[model samples]
Target: MDTINTDILICGAGAAGLTLAIELARRHVDFMLVDKIDGPFSGSRGKGIQPRTLEIFEAMGVVDRMVAAGGAYPPQRKYRADGGYDEQPSTEGLAPSPAEPYNLPLMLPQYLTEGILRDRLAELGHAPRFGQELTGFEQHADGVTARLARADGTTTTVRARYLVGADGGRSFVRKALAIDFPGESMKMRAMVADLSLTGLDRGAWHRWGDGPGQISLCPLMGTDLFQLQMPVPLEGDIDTSDAALAAVIAARTGRADIALHAVHWRSVYEMSSRLADRYRVGRVFIAGDAAHVHPPTGGQGLNTSVQDAWNLGWKLAAVVDGAPDALLDTYEAERREVAAAMLGLAGKLLEAARTRGDLRRGRETQQLDLGYRTSPLACDARGDDAIVRAGDRAPDAPCRGAAGQPLRLFTLLAAGGWTLLRYEPDGAGVVAPRKGLRIVTVGMDGELRDDGGHLRTAYGFAPGEVALIRPDGYIGALASDERGPALNTYIANSLI
Candidate 1:
C-alpha cells in the first residue's frame, strides 16, 4: 500500500469535516480530508444556519456567499382540516443588533452550505478526497496511523500527528474506539425528503395535520424544491417511493390538487438523542455526529457540529505547532459540554413538536448565548458582575480604524489569529508585541477608536482593561487593568 504522511487526518467530509479543513488550510496546516461518498452530499437534511454559526462563517470569510445564497426562514402556515391555515412567524420579534448582527437563522439547504464551504476550501488549495473511506486507525502517544479504502478497492496508509472523526451517527471511528453512546430512542419516527411539487405557494412553510399524521413542506431557498417532513409509524417500514409519498400527502392534506413531481431525496429516521461518553482517545478525537446526535426539531445538529469543528480546529493547529499537548484536551472539554446542552434543547423541542405541534423557534435556538464560561482556559480578573467575561463570545461592535475607516470587531478578527483589545484611554500603552497575536488598542487615538462607545458598551469593559480574544472568537481572558500581571499570566498559563 502507498504510504502518505500528513499533520492531520480528518474522516468524513461533511459540514464538520469541511469546516475543520477550511480552518487548517487558512492557517497553512497540512491535513487530509476524506469522505466515504463519491461526491458532496446531495440532501437538504440540515437546513438552518443559526446566528452564532453565521459569525463563525464570517470569520472563515464565507458569510457573504452564504447570505447571498440563503434567505430568512419564512412564516409557518399550519393548515386546518377545512383548508384554512394559520400563519406564525418562524423567528418572532428577533432583530439584528450591533452586538449580534445575524440574529435570525438563514434557511439554506445542507447541500448548498457544504458546497459553499467546499468552494472556500478549494480556494485555499485543498479539497476533500472523496471516494476514500477510513476503514481503520490506530493511535499512539505521538501520532496516529489510519487505513483508507478507495472506491476502486485500492488501499492506502496515512500517518498523521492527529486524527479526527467527523463521520455521521453510525460512525465507524466511534464504534471502533469502544466509546459508549448511551441514550434512549424516542418512540417517534419521521420521513424527510426533498421533492419537486406544485399547487402550493413558496412564500410560507406549509403544514398539515398534527401528531402521528403531521406533514410539513418547506420551500427550500435558492431552489425550486420543497423539503417534505412527516411522521411515520414506529414499527412499520416506510415506503419512500414517489408514489407512496404523493399518496401520503393526499391522504393527510385532503387536497388532491397538490402534485408531487419528483422525489429528489428521501430518508426515514427514528428520533434519538445520544452523546459520546468521551470525545478524545489519545491522539484520536470525534466531532459532529460522531460525538453527539440530536433530534432535528431545534435544527441544532448541524450548527453544533460546525461549531465543534470551529472549536477543535484552532486547538489542533496550535498543538501541531508545538503548543502543549494539554491544549488539545480543551476541545473535548468545551465542545462536549456544549453538545450535551444542545442535545437537551433539541430533545425539548422534539417533545414540543410531538405534544403541542408548536414549531415556533425562539431566541434559545439562535445559540448566541452558548459559551465556554466554565472551561479551564477561561480566566477573568474582572468580577462576576461583568456582563461579557472570560469564555463568553466576543461580541462585535461598529467602530472606526485609526485612519477613520469603518470597521467591525469581526472584521478585525477575520485575519485568523489571537486579538487583544486593549482599552487604553490615552492610546499610549507600554504593552510589548507578541508573535501570533494582534493587539488593537481601543482609545481616543488608538488603532481603533470607539467613537460611539459602542465597543465599550457591548464588551462591558472600562478603559485600561484588556480582553484576550481567542482565535475561535471567544474571550479567553479579561483583565481589569492592562498593566496587571493577570493578562501575562493568562497568556503563559492558558493561552499558549
Candidate 2:
C-alpha cells in the first residue's frame, strides 16, 4: 500500500467530477480526481447542454471547443403508424443580448463533452486517474482518509482536506455516509442505445408512437451516430443485445428498409426522482448523481450536475486558500435548494411528457432563471427596484478597458479572481482593495468604460454602485449606500 495527500479528493470522473477538477486545477488547488472506469464514458448518456451550462463552460475556458464540437438541436419529424411523417421546427432561436449570450440550448453527446473537459484539465496539467476505485473513506474533523484500490489488487491511502462523491446514483460514498435518498421509484423504464445506421435521414430527430410506446432516433451532432430511445416494459428481463435492440427499432419504426450497422452501447434505464437527505457530512460531500437523481426530462440531469460542481469548485478553492470553513457549509445550502427545484421541474416535465405528449424544449429548460437570492450569501442592499441583485448571475456587458480596447464583462471577470465593479467614487468607500480581489471602476472616465451605458443597463445599477462578483461569476454582494459596512462585513466573514 502507498500513501498520498491532496487538498481535495474527487471520486468519479463524469461531467461533474471533471468540471470540478478543471476548476480546481485552474485555481492551482491540489486535488486528485479518480474514476473506477479505465477510460472516459462511451455512451451518449446526457446529450443536451443547457444555456446556463454553456455560460459555465465559457467561464471554464472551453466553450469555444464545445460550440465547435456540437450543433443546434435538429428539427423533430413525427411518424405515425400509417407511415405519415410530420416535421416540426427544431427549436426557437433566441437572440443573444449583452446579459445572456448563450440563450439557446446546445446539442452535444455527453461523452464528447466529458472529453473536452478532460482535454482542458490536461491543459491545466492534471489528468483524472482512471481505473482507481474508492473502496472506502473515513472523515475526521480536519480531513478525510480515502482508500482506493486498483484492479490488480494494489491499494493506496489518500488523505485530503475534503472528499467529493461525484459518483453515480448508486453511489458507495452516499451509502457509506448513510444518507437517505428519499423519492419515488419510477415504474416506467426505457431502452436506449447508440448505433450507426443506414437508410434513415440524418437531418431531423425522428419519432414514432405515443406515451409509453414512444420511440425516437435523434442524430448525434459532430459524429456519424444516432441515439435510439424507446419506452420499455417494467416487467420481465430486458434484452440489451444488439440484435434485440435492432429488432425493437425495426418493429417500432414499422420499416424493414432501415439497417442497424453498428451498435456502440446499449442499456435499459430505470429512473428515480430522488434527492439525498444531505449533500454533506462533515468533510465529505456528494455532488451530481450522488446528491440527486432525475428522469431524462428537460435535459436537467447532466446540466444540473455540472452546475453543482461549478458552484462547489470555487468555494472549495477559496476555503483552501484561507477563507472560513463555514463557507463550505454554504455549498449544501445553495445547491441543495437548486437540486430540489430541478427535481420538481424535471418531474413536471416527465409527467407532461407522459400525459400530454409534449417533447419540445422550452425556455424553462435553459436553466438561466436559477438564482441564489434566498441564500445567506446573497446580501443585496440595492432594493427590489433593480432587475439584477446579489445571488443573481453576473451578467455580461460590452465595455472598454483602460487602454480604450474593447472588452466584455465576462472577459474581465475571467482574470481568475473576485471582481469589484465600482461605478465611480461615490461607492468608493466600500472598496477594501484586498489580495485576490480586483477593483475595476467602470464609467466615463473610469478604468473600464461602459460602451453605450450597457453595463449600467444590464447590471441595473446607477453610478456609485459597487457590485462584488464572485469567482464563479455570481454577484456575492452589492452596495447602494456609500457608508454601509455590509460590504466589508460580507468580505470579512465570507470571503476574507
Candidate 3:
C-alpha cells in the first residue's frame, strides 16, 4: 500500500496554489501544491494588481519584492459616465481612504506575479510539486486520498487532512467532488495580447470605446510592450483575421502610428460569469476560478481567488492543529456569499459594457469597494442588526493598537491567531462563549461620517468600541453594548 499524508494537498500550482502553500509554510503546516505546467508561460494573462491585493501581499510578506521587480504606477485612468476616460480619477483618485495607500494600480503581468509568489514560497522553504497532475481523490472518514499522475506517467497517492482545488475553471478536483458550476456564457469575445503597441496612448489603462472597436491598452512591467485587450462583441467576430485585429486597434485609437509585434497569446472566451453552487464538499474545497469563473470585468477574478486561498489556508491549518472541524464551514459560508455577489456584479459590468451606457451608475453605485458586508463572524453589536448587517471582506486601516506603537490593522493580525477589537464598549465584551473561540478587542471611538472614506473609513473608528477582526480579514462578531460575551462566544466557537 502506497500512501503519503500531508496536512493539505492543493491541486493546480498556479497563483492561488502557490499563495496557499506560502501561507501554510508560514504557519509551519506541512502541505504540497501540484500543477501540470512545470514552467512559466510567456503569455500575458492578468496585468492589473489592485491596491487591496498588494496590501494582502504586504501582509503575507511579498509585496516589496514585487514592487521592486515591477514599478509603481502613480496614476490610473477613470472612465467618465459615458464609456470614456478623461479626468474623473485617473491620477486624481488616491484611494481617498486613510487606512490604505490607494495611489496606483501595481502594474505586473500575471506570469511575473506568479514568479514573485513562487519565489516567496521558496523563501519559506517550499517549492511547488510541479508536473504532478491531479487525477482523482477519495475522501475517507479521517483524511482525503488524492491520486496524481506524475511526469513519468506513474500514478501516486497523496493522503491529506484536506484538499483544495486552485486549478482553473476546468478543475479536476471539482469534477471529483461532483459539484455544479452554474452560469451563462455571453458571446462577448476579446483578443488579448501582451506586446509592443504602435499608438496606444501613455496612461495607466487606455480605455477607448468607439464605432469600429474598443480597446484597453495597459502597459506591462519589465517589457517595453503594453498588454492590449481588444474587445469583439458576440454578434460578430469582427477581427477574425490578423489584419482585421490591427485595423480594429487603429480604428479605436484613430492612430495608425502603431507598430505590431508577434502575438504572444490569443484566446476567445465567451465571457460566462459563473459561480459554484458550493465551495466545499466532504474533505474537498474549491477556490479561485474553480469556485467562480466570471468575466474579467472588475479584474476581480484573481483577487477573489487569492482571497479564497487566504481564507481557507489558516482555517485548514487551524483544524489540523486541533481546532474543531466545524471551523472550516465558515470558509464556504463567507466566500461563497462574496463570490455570488461578484457574479451579479460581473453580469452588471458586462451589461454596461455591451449597452455602453451611463458608467456613473456602474462605477459609483456598483461600489466594488464597499459591496462586501455579510458574515455571522461579523455580527452586529446587538444581535439581529449584527447578523443581518453588511457581510464582506474586511477592510484595512491605520491604527494605534493596544500597543501605542505605529501599526497597520493588518500588521496587527497575528500571523496565525485571531484578532479582536472593541469598536464600541457598551456591552460587546460581556458576551459569553457560545463555543470554541479566539478574539481581541481593540477600542474604537464610535463615529459614522460617510460610506465616505476608503478602507479606513469602512472599518475605522475613534476609540472605546470594539472591532473584531478575523484572521482572513473578515469581521467575525463585533459588539458595542456587550463586549465580553460576544468576544468569548465568537472566538471560542472558532477555536474549537
Tell me the alpha-carbon RMSD of every candidate: 1.1, 1.4, 5.4
Q: Which stretches of candidate 2 lie over 4 Å from their true place?
A: 426-430
Q: Point out the worst 10-residue segment of candidate 3 by lDDT.
A: 358-367
lDDT for 170 (candidate 1): 94
lDDT of 1 by residue, 1-496 (tens): 9999999899999999999999999999999999999999999999999999999999999998999998889899999878799999988546788888988898899999999999999999999999998998888777999999987889999999999999999999999999999988977888999999999999999988878888999999978999999989999777898899999999988888999999999999998989999999988899999999878998898999999999999999888777898998899889999988998899999889888889989889989999999998898998888889899999999999989899999999988788988986544665567767888988866889888888888988787888989999999989877777878877766544
Q: Which stretches of candidate 1 lie over 4 Å from their true place?
A: 426-430
In terms of lDDT, which candidate is stronger, 2 or 3? 2
- Clash number for model 1? 0
Of the candidates shown, which would achieve the greatest lDDT relative to the real structure?
A: 1
lDDT-best of 1 and 3: 1
Q: Candidates' TM-scores?
A: 0.98, 0.97, 0.81
Leading candidate by TM-score: 1
Worst 10 residues of 2 by lDDT: 424-433
True lDDT of residue 306, candidate 1: 98
Candidate 2 lDDT score at position 255: 83
How much does candidate 3 score in TM-score? Answer: 0.81
